[model samples]
Target: MTDLHAPAHPGASGTPVPAVPEQPGTAGTPGTPARDAVPAEKTGEPKRNRRRVRIDHLRHVVVEVREHAGYRTVVRHAAYTAGGARLLTRRAWDSRTTARHERMMRAAEAAGNEELVRQWEQRAYAYRFARHRRRVELLQMAINAPKAIGYATATGVGTLLILGFLITLGTGDTSDLLTPIEAVVDFVGWVSFLASVIWEPALYSLPLIALGAAWTVGRRQHTAPAWALPADAEDRDVVPDEGAIIKALSNLGIAPLNKAIKDGWQPRWVSPTTRSGPGWHTQLQLPMGVTVEMVNGKKKVLAHNLLRKPVEVWPTEPPKLPGTLDLWVADQGSLSGPTPPWPLLTEGTVDYFKGVPVAVSQRGEPIMGKLMAANWMVGGIMGSGKSSLVIALLLGAILDPLVDVEAYVMAYNVDYDPLKPRLRALVKGDEDEQIEAAVHALRRLRDEVTERGKLLEELGGDNTKLTRELAQKDPRMRPKVVVFDECHELFMHKEHGKEAAELAVKVMKKARKTGITLVWVTVSPTADSIPRDVTRNTSHRVAFAVGDHVANDGLLGSGKHKAGVTATTLIPGEDVGTAVTVGFTNKPFEVIRSHYVAREAEKGVDEVTPVVKRALKAYKVGDVWEVPETAAADVLTDVAAVLGDEPRMLTQEVLHRLAERNPSAYLEWGPTDLKAALEPYGAEQYKSGGKSMVSRTRIQEAILDRLAEADEDEGDPEI
Candidate 1:
């Protein structure tokens, strides 16, 4: 029972054998040994056929020298050197494996065989076209932004003008013949005065200005656009590493970019290939299979490629695709247990502190990488890993020496005694003192902000550029990150409001280049309590499971917040360490879990209680300016209930309108009283509009004041 599927037991070849189908009902079962055998026809080895692809010695030499009679003479080679010197193979051929497959197909005539062949051919074709298309792009760029073209144009115009001026000087001689030399000297002196202050008679500045314009045109406009991103998309594509793509293509029997392009084929843009960041839009047309067809009845190119998930596209003039990305990765190691080494723990992710990764398309590229601007806002409820995240951030700061990041934490909570060991201690200040510290920090920030404004004014550029300049000048002057936990106290305390709010605006406006970022967390916020402009201007936001939609609106935008989201929205999979991250671009990314540093230390217990007591006492200390609490309903109703039901006097609406509308002498109730009575009704609840009545308590007070001020005619009473 010789198996036909098996290829003649290795050495036994050239013997023809029958084909076997591996379908489920047929002979293809794994238990069936014959089903997995290679056919005898595919067993034969193919003889190698070589073609010369080496550099020809005679063709390679442009110049030749011969030593004769103790002297050597060099002379150019005669002709036909270029053709033979280069042995670039133009076309590729099938290997022995292909021949074996062909033989098997010829014997069996299977559909599977045909499909495999077609896929191979298509892959080869796509690769051939990619290189040529890239070259086409390069040529287009050269034509579009050629230095020679600009240089030629500038030279031609400058030469023509200079020649015309010289000719005019030789032919006209307008200076000496027409005007006196004293006039030119006076004009020059006046122009110099103008250059200094107000005089502008100097004619020499014209040529200089022209030269400056040409110089600016020749250089400034030539700089490349800052950003270039993908088109027809609101997001970015994340491609696999280049090594993977190369291996996959090799396994699939497809030629790579060079071969595919030369053969005028489109290779499938498959994954496992290196990905360039956002700005790169693929202009080279690839065979997209039958998916993208032309409306017109014409031939269309198609290829097979794989695409990865897209990321939210950040804005830039000409967007640049990122070489690497920082994904807030989930399923990280648990902080409760022993932690693994960074590389082993975060094998695929960028280092938490370093944030570095390999760039796509470029081999051995230098990556300085993006640094986190020392400022960021972090917030979460008590058990939502807020403390852990802070600890992790601190540890990360300690790890990264390049940025030289420093941290300053300000806790206004009464029970900050727990932070004594970790946080460099600040005084156990009263509520007012805590607020004062917040304000004092802001005041220091004020001077810094003023300095930055002046710098921007003087330098005439944005804060980002200014930051780069400052960083370059001072290495030790590292970025500073300001952290505020339970910062609501700062705003809740009335005294710190004006200074804090003003400081927030100032730092936000000018802090970009200064490497100062603000990170504040509050448990609750109200409309009047939190600054509106600050919330709106903050580009990066993270709102964990908050209490309500209003807080949602504060973190996310107003529309999205109120629409579908609620404060108690629970992500089912996460028990803890769950959050949502958003960047300046406002792309919300969900986080199921996060890794944080273990608590190496804790603040002492007794100290925290005293601090809390001190803070509470200072806050509760009796003050004259303190407002007495009145129930909300009391302010709205109670004493005011009489006004809601009463009639009004001296009412603007009642006098003339009452004459026709009501026609009554006993009109104790005017339109004013009528309107007042309708106070309980809403805008739509009422049939008409009128002034609301004043509360009786307020009315009585007003009456007493007026009576005291009134002048009575007591002497002429009733005479």
Candidate 2:
């Protein structure tokens, strides 16, 4: 009784392969004709026999195991083995799990010595269509490039239509001598003939234009500038103009991005949320997309002459969360000089970019990103606005993720108190803690310098730059900065003073080019404050408001005195918080204005401070203070917090009420401590001493109940 029933396999002949046992249950007998067991029609037709199509006990169990682990990976391997077409797709690219499944299936096949080909075929059912879809998407980007040429024809045909309409308006004499209109029309016809002839010569030139365009695109790597809407910018239409283009271009500092925008290319606006706190901004995202290409005749896309670049307009600007800037920039203030008819610096990133417009070129090169670090340091100081000057320097160093750089703070008697809130020790908003942290940070930097020198010696390297160079050639090394703030404060302190001087000397004299740039900020140019050795070899010097000729002499010496800049004029008698910056190649200029970031913006506020405080403490306890590569930005943000303003943590009303009697006492309180003390109470806070306070939600409700007995009178936001 040859009742033949067996599993089908493409690998063997047109016969059912033998089925052997691998799992608990076994199916039809081996050597049976699998098709005969099912039906004759099903074996020849495309559709499989319905009975076989249905998963049996073994097939069903295999699927269940795969789902519990990872189904995608299993599917990927099945497809890889079944490849008559390109099998792996974008989704399947990460199918390591599927690959594992395939391996497992192979092992089972070899161990049992059973038919494996049929199982592989059954597992591939899900992926046949999915792989096709991804391939189509990849082809579209290139397919659309040729369509850009169509834009030129519309302009040309429209111009021709106008000319033809005008020609119809003229009346001409048909017989004998020509009338005036006839003569004019004849002249126009001849001009058209000439234009046609000239166009032939340019046909040759057209190819050259294409070659140039290709060359431009090839040399310029595709990096677009990040766009930011101002805090107050609304849904009002932003007319796409050269100015806006230039401003956009300025951000990249590398490519002419504005040109790309102007030439009608589409732009990609990323989510603007920072890497660390992506969830911070819950606001709706801006909707925008930009694309550009030149479509030739017949609506074919032209590669060289890109006709249209699309840009999608966003509904709203992305909100800048606190401590976000530190992630983008490297060190602050490189080319920080002033220029202009207004109080502007010659070049700092902030000073020059505060109000200037920017955009990408058709080729996407930025016009201004290069200007921030222009002439190195000597050129950026003068034009950089007072508040933005530091921002300018820092923006270049800190914002550039690709470059390896860091900044040191040597601030003394300066207005850079906005940086305290983010310092781990000062997060509680303690004033003394803020000061101690600053001092502690300086000491740490000095120690870092000593360690760096030793490390370099051990490696037979002299500087950080050289160390980085060698490390790149090898491995096992990191690029770091020993930063200093209010370094002039070093002169005031007794124990750390000499150490600060020694550190400054070591940095300026030997480590300047070793990737170390001394950021020496001071109120005076007095020779006594800054060492002559520092001034002599030091290539960059930034001068702010100071007193008398001594200040001027301490900087440019008597050389700048004849230039009409004196200490008295630099700082008016009563007013403070102003200064002048001198750089390498930039002329001395004034930095009069800059946007001061709110304290909360620099320091992590209520939304995340509690979490940060716990994390900072956890790092201390677990001895896991090392910065992760991905988390390095947060540590750098801590650096910016140290550079930013004092946290105005508490509400303004409470501080005002607390200080109503002894105004001086509240005024003198370090902004760091003042903010933390009032956080639970709730209040408006500011860096420049205009502190405020408000009652907490719970406390305010209680106060409302006792309003008749209360001493004060200002109401809450709603109440």
Candidate 3:
């Protein structure tokens, strides 16, 4: 009997055939065939006594196909269950079989065996397709299982409820979705009848919804005042996220951070906070073997990655945790706000013992330094507010009665012109005579340091250092502060360079005990311009925007840049008056913006001039001395006296005679010094008798020329 209940296999068109009914007692089961059974082959020959037997009830079958090489073989199997029949496995005979076949395939491919490559590719595709089909069947079973269905349904419902509640709360709506009582009442009212008729609950509840919304709006307005709301509600406060910052630091390719992260280490991020004004502050606990220096070295790259402008990176202190870095990111490219005005010194009693306010820190706290017993070095690139910082310090010093101010402005800037009357010595211009005068003043200060040291030693009570009590007892021991603006000019001078540098180094090292403060301001902070002897001994250092880290470290102490206090990050012109101050008492390193003193407009004086003048008048009585206004006339008269009764004299003879006339001023005068003094007056030095000699007639003519120019200047009317 032919069985008709056999399970169908796929036909040539890739479609399943209809199942046939099975015969009783002819196969292993109802729908499967016997495991050893094989299908009859169709032949073109006559058959003898052929029985049309139908096989059935096959539970599983494995078929193996082998190539002639005996090494390449494939095994395929199929299994059937109540769900349906599926391919159970399709695999190589052995693991090495595929590898060997791949090697042959590569050889064929390299030899351009397109036909062989295609045959192998088709075989590989068939095997992968069978495996993928099995995987998909298993995935489908898992997805459609009862547990998965129940879990997914619960998750979806919970998510929807949460979203609805959040939306209702955020919108401040008292709608049916959020209010249970209102929802029940609406459900039971005539609106329910309308909803049943219209087949839309939302449409029927429109009137109730409108009233609830109106009530919510009115209640909110009544409870919350307009003034309580933020002025700019739409403004975004874009605080930096810690996760984003770590990602940025990782992207910077820093070795320490990358290696730590690669080694499965994670940094602990602290909550970010707003800085006082222009920036944000955050901290990170770095992984072991990583350091703050490692992070600080890549500050610029980190700033680039974080999309912020100029980050300040430093190690954490106070609590002083190792491997901790504190990062400050500016809100914009430049620090916000204008420079604060110079504070008036008139309200309180002036105390030279304690410092005065010269600048403001980034936190807006006043930055004061003791100018009485400390030497100061101010260095920066040009136009970086070195002059302004120096002026602020000078204004602070001059306001005190105990401070005797002297300034040598080698640049001849008119900013210090108003201070001339109060200055013990004022030397201006970059000429040779001005340089000589600066050298002379430095030498005089060096001698005074010795004299004051002796005085302090003699007046020693508990301390040999000059105290306010000692200064009060002896008026001559008043604190002397000398400012050398553009001091590089004096240090780099051809003739007086060596002597000037030596004298400056001496004053900076030994003068602090004697109550003499030397404020040296220079644009160039290189070793050649300002020696290490002077830079290292100076008690206070302020650095403005410089060219590079080398200059920054030079101005601030060595290793300061590596330790993460750097001024090189400051912009040149935009960050004017902003500097890093070191050696201050309150803070080891602080960023300060010096008080700005505006330039005089016509006769209008600076904002600080009036206050300084008043302070000087009240406290600086009998201390201020007027410098001789006729320096040129006095020099010419001295020259005439030196060349008495002779048509001309040797330069040496003139110097000797001038030294005799004004020994205090000309005691150290040389030929070069004499020439520098008289050069502005057009005095001529000529060679006579193989010796350098000055002509008396030329000196007289020079004096007459100066008188004539003075007459011409007086003849012109004031514009």
Candidate 4:
């Protein structure tokens, strides 16, 4: 059987014949099938396309030549001449008319400053009037010039002749009269010869000199394209002039900005670029359909266009000039270097109400952070120097002896061990018990907040909020700061995470007005690690280098990343101590390099240890400060309470009574322990009657003296 769908079969001549299917229209009329009509000679032959090969080779050669140094240098020189000529023409036009004044008026109008607009208008009118007056005076002088010159010439000749005549009379030489006229003729001849000799050469060189001047100006301003500039000068820092700013804004990859620039829109300079600290500051009024946020989002691209590092370019929204961008471009490498030493290292004391200097802005301005009535959320990755920032804040708060400081580090890190004596509560461990302790600390802080609120209410008379005076007046109402370091461990704990987070949120919500500051330091910035409730209530946020935009917004507030205020831009190790903080400084936000205080083991004792010792020495033994409910009782305060109006008591008997009061705290206390505790207060036990006894009068007097000294040192507390 012959099958039409069968595979091809070999023929007698060793060529395979393909089977063809019968078609409805072509079966009876066609001589051969269309598929079998193709010629065998033209099958599978390679073709050479020489034209495309030659075109591609030519393109490669052209690219190579364009990238050569000589080619770039020639292009740069050509651009220099053109740019210089344009600059000179613009300068001449401005000087000859009121274009400069008109531009300033427009800038003032855009900035919404009516006063500046009026001032510029008056100046422009004065310029026009003065120009017309000068033209009229020139015409008048031309009309009267011939008569005045003739008269002046005749007067000068007559005076010279009279002098000559007098000399002739004295010397009796009649020819001397003609001597003055002959000398004048010779001077005129000499002047004519000199002018003839110099005039032609000066005329021939004038145009060349003008061209050279233009070239010099162009090169100085770096008006060439970036690709055409020399290799060494391509990325060099520019002066941040008007042209540079325009170029940066135009190339920011922003659609509206680029479109506006292409359509002949010009920037309105509300303030000219001026040197400010280690940078240049300027205010710009953007065109329609373009926003400061758009510019901010392209900060890295804009910085590269302006020949600067991304960190060096800062664009902010100006407070006074609404709808304008406040731009600050730092000097090359200024912000990347180390910040200045801490101010307190040499000599200083902090008053909590006045705020403390925690860090310095990139502009070298101090960042004053309010510790009282403020809660902070500090977030960063490990080794991002978040701990260093925490230490700086703690150092500032603890320096004020009246403020109570406590820290609970979830990890076994000893960075804060040197200040343990000054810290009311210093707990450091990764154990379950330590995490439980931190949870208990938060519970106690919540209770203290409630107590302080009631105390403030009792004061009455518009003292609705706690003030420095109130904190000084009441023993239990002093300013207290509680820090939970590596708080993610506590928040993510299997047993107590939910309860801990709830208590933290409650404390943060009510602590602001109660003179208690709650600082949560977390390594992970995920929603699970740091709850949204904590971040939302803690208005002041400090974020070091983080992982991504999600973490960035979690550490900072939502929409901060999109607003171009992000810590994710910060490099981890290089920008260890640097952070972007909001609601902490006078401005809405700032990028600051926090002051560092190293540990004693790292040879930083000279800076930190001295401050801690001073704080310890300044501590009042019996004065009431903040302490957790589970904390051990104060030895001095307990002794005073145990005395209870007794004239005197034996030391052994007092210890027995203290043991009854708080067995876990003072159960093992002996006469020696009692003496040791009272020694610092200057109210040690003394021999009375027959046995060693504690004096009630001495202890009471000591407490009164301590209170008096506090009042004297602090004077009137700042409100």
Candidate 5:
């Protein structure tokens, strides 16, 4: 029995021999018969099993634990506690000493601001004096403690005794004196018993409370390191605070700025943080050797440090403050969001002399620029919102009936179809004929400028420029605005390019004072695309997104790129309708996001068609100032007619009513125009309920005065 399936053991020579099992088909051989053979597969053992699998499994478990959310949160909170303690200690130290004042004084001295240095020195001295006086008072109080306590105890005991005597008299009993003292002893004993009951629990909770407070401070201040913080922590839209701003500036890699910060340079806040429009605005005085230009150049880096996108942070120079940085930070994703609707879309009118609301500043304030007495050069690549901005300006113009808006779009699209009714002359298409028409329009504008100048001289006014009254009274002197979209086609045309450039230049130079505005727009901005003479004479320059610096400077101005006023920083598709504009603000340059007016029809809604219809109606009726001689009457009469039975009307409402009554005569009338009309009769607009109101009674009285004057003139003719 031990013979068949037994393994061979080591022999005397210590050599091992292998044992072989019976083959599958040879079950019943003579020497090896088939016993009940057990299969190796049924044993459930792997032939290649080794120790490496266990090691791998352990490593995977370790990784899972490390990656768990619960673990991360625990580590983050621990870090927060540590960081908060350090911050609180530093703050406590600064409060106890003159560290803040001393730091500001050093910064001021480095900036060569002696006045600020002296001011900080005075403040530090005052703080020291105040602190010293407080310390002396504390010392005196400590010295008088024991005597004061003794007096208080004696007085309290005597009062209690007197009360007890009073009580005894009332009770008329001998033992009543001890009753009050016994009650007092009971009260103290009860208080001690309560304290003993609460003491242990309170002691245990105090440390936890302290730890919770530390965590709160750290969480609010974002004190955890980046790795420990939540994955989306950096994406949070945190408003820029003083510490964040200082940290960003300090890390800008400017040697001088970094050095100054290391030497305790803190921002001298010219203005505290205040909500401006849709963002936060503050003015900071940079440390010495840190110019506004330097800060402007590092806008992307600064924005990143503040946990914001590059488009969300805007840094500019405060006028007349050389070292000052005017900073504004928008709410996260706000710039990418849709802007507010145009004010004129629902109800509003434009006064060409005052200005038109075209775009909004990065801070979300309305940006107004004068359309009269100015020339604009606008440039951007295709799909960069060049045409949209021009459309915004044109929309403002049509609201005023006196302004005749003419547009010649070379690369014709249906974007301008809604405005066709209001446009005086609309030329579309990029053909040679279209190019010639644009040039011809420029030629006519140039001639008109010359004729208007001569007319202004003939009027015999001391003022050389056209005035509102003069223009309103004489229809020929009315304001004219000409827009040339895709103007490069005309400016670079072989046949008419030279004449177009010359005529545009002439009109821009002379027509500013003559009440003509030229808006030159182009997708291609080059010396050949936009003539040098045109860019030279243009007063206002707006540059949208462009591919390179040369194109940016071509529209903004030469040397503008080097000066840190560049449009190249603008994102292409994401920043449509956003532009860098000069001559709009007093600063070197400003970024404006133009109000979006949908050009293509969307969901059967059209923004431009209705407005254009209104403009068309007003224009066809003609200027309100042009009343026929047979109907010749004073402005008082017109006001009375518009006022009807209403006792008082808002000045703006009156203007609208006047336009409605006689679009021919009052279509161009504005607040100033109405005021000027009323001034002659010693009648003026007044505010009622915080709104500009015109009284009907005042209009009636002014009419009577005009009638009386007319009678006088007729009756007193000399022989």
Candidate 6:
């Protein structure tokens, strides 16, 4: 018998006879042997030994094949281990595997490894063929086993029943065998009858049918376009689908949102709603450790993930709940337009001490702010409606019957001309006089703060703050609002910049308790323009479009932009009057659109002028009163007038006379106060015969020096 597992070589032959080798065509190349063949030299061994060797070799081959197949199976099953069993059921597995094979084949070819490339191509073909064969087998098995059995059973039962009927017809015998069949038929007939009886009520329920039809129609109507457009015109303004949005958000791998959905944290998605105007609204019930502020801080990233503009995607919280995120996505790229007109002021009626409506919120509700005990800082880029917002705030205070309005416009604009007449002090220009006037106003406000401080201390209850009761008792203590428009001009002045900034910081710190409100507006919101101390003390901040985060934080407080009250996303000309305001509403930060206050035709006055005039008439002693052109000039002359026929006078006596002349202006004057006020102008108090006194000569010299400087400023070619 031929040995199947023999070594193809002669054994123990001294002559060394050459054995016939297998043909290279059948065995492989000349250097290689057939995998299943053995050498012929070992054929002389015992049959039993040869048989044992062949069995052991076969067992080894089987083990190796099994091990290789097991490795492949483990590799294929890894997908299930990583992403769950759903991956195995999806057709994506086949496509992904095919793509991977193609990539590997291309890489192998690029590396010039022909053998590796061929091997990969063969493996890919084998895998695809095996997958197809297995799928076919499963499908055939599914089709043949239960379905064929069921069909055969059904056919047999029908034939038996038909045969029984025929047998009864032919034999005409009602026996026990037929009785069981008869009972079954009767049972089936009864079941059909009951089923029909149950269905009868459904046929007559017209109300339910009508209600369902109505609901379907209503749903269709609700989803229909609100306005008609020509065919073939793309409607880019359509709201995005909520399901698609949620899926996209999930794909972004946002930790809070994804973890909530995966870990059964009760993640609930709400249907998107429409805003009052042109925005889409949606809410998400945030998981633990997730807050609206957290989401808002990542607004730019979220916008990129959603493939939308940053300005179009706004994330906020419901006014009361921080855990519920309210996302507003504008249909238009910009959240501008449909701004309501400014409300008409009610003469002698509006009370602004508590709050006044300045703008409308995203939800169309009015946004109100309290001017009492509050200081405002408004900042934005040029043409960002900074002036309009300032006017809106001023209109609120100006319409109130008990408030005094003082505006200093350093960078003069025509917008303020209408309200000029009603202003107790209106200083507008970029000239030296204007700069000096603004500085003088700040100094006077500082003095007034000191006087009010003294009055509050005498009252003794919460002495730092002036209460409404005190204001009611003394009308002079009513709200005094000072607006500095284009205030950067004052801080940029070479001569007075440092002193002006210092005085502003002091006023912001000390004025809140004395019924004084400072509203400062600037186009350049920077550390150089707005001092840190002034920015920090101001409680109310409004920031429209700005250049960058630095400007945003300078206007709004430090780290406020990171906290998600960012105005940098706003576009200057596009967003117009839209702004992010803090301390205006119950929310930490709100996006507001101020109303447009149109300018009036008569007297170059705007809608705000008449309101301010009415407010001044109702509050001030006369129809109109002029403020001193310069506090320094007026103080010098007033002191000289009080010192008439006397070379020197006690500081106390001068303060007493000044207080009598203007009690509200000088109620807290003291020797130190007099010296500090006069020191800026090169005047000094001295000891004259055991009493501290001021010299008229020194006061006159200081006045002349200031006048000379003013004259030089007027003569300069730059002016």
Please tell me which predicted candidate would have the highest lDDT against the true structure.
Answer: 4
Instruction: Give every collision pair in model 6.
Output: 6-39, 7-39, 7-40, 8-39, 8-40, 9-41, 600-606
| Model 5: per-residue Cα lDDT at residue 343 | 63
lDDT of 1 by residue, 1-719 (tens): 32536541111111222232232222344244432434433644222211110111111121111212121111111111221121111112233124433433332222223544554454444545665788899899888877878987788656655665675677785443333334545888888876777434446676666455444432222111111111221221123223222222223332233233333343432111222322222211223221111200111111111132111111111112121111111111221222222211121211222332111111111111123432444455566545544443433332322232222334533333343333322443436766677677767766875665565555545534344345434443334445556666666666677668778877876676555556666555445656766666565555555665676666655643422322335332243444444452222332222343333233432323332232222222332111122222221232233344454433333233232121122123444344454343321112212222233444445445445556454444685
Off by over 4 Å in 4: 1-189, 196-237, 248-273, 282-299, 315-327, 603-605, 624-719
lDDT of 4 by residue, 281-392 (tens): 7888898887788887888888888778776787877666666888888888777877767666655566666566677777776666678779899988888888777787
TM-score for each predicted model, relative to the true structure: 0.33, 0.28, 0.52, 0.63, 0.60, 0.51
Each model's lDDT comes to 0.37, 0.35, 0.66, 0.77, 0.75, 0.68
| Candidate 2 lDDT over residue span 274-307, tens digit each | 2211111111111123111111011111101112
The C-alpha stretches of model 2 lying farther than 4 A from their native spots are: 1-388, 391-447, 457-489, 492-500, 513-517, 563-580, 584-719
For candidate 2, report its TM-score: 0.28
Assess the local accuracy of residue 66 in candidate 2 as a C-alpha lDDT between 0 and 100.
Answer: 38
Compute the lDDT for candidate 5. 0.75
Model 5 residue runs over 4 Å out of place are 1-237, 255-275, 282-297, 600-603, 621-719
TM-score of 6: 0.51
User: What is the Cα-based lDDT of residue 149 in candidate 4?
Assistant: 96
Give the poorly placed runs of model 6, Cα more than 4 Å off. Answer: 1-245, 251-309, 316-334, 345-348, 459-464, 467-469, 600-606, 616-719
For residues 506-537, write the lDDT of model 6, one tens digit per residue.
98888877889998898899998888888888
- TM-score sort, best first: 4, 5, 3, 6, 1, 2
Candidate ranking under lDDT, highest first, comes to 4, 5, 6, 3, 1, 2
True-structure lDDT of candidate 2: 0.35
Q: Which of the predicted structures, 1 or 3, would earn the higher TM-score when compared with the native?
A: 3
lDDT of 4 at 684: 87
Better of 1 and 2 by lDDT: 1
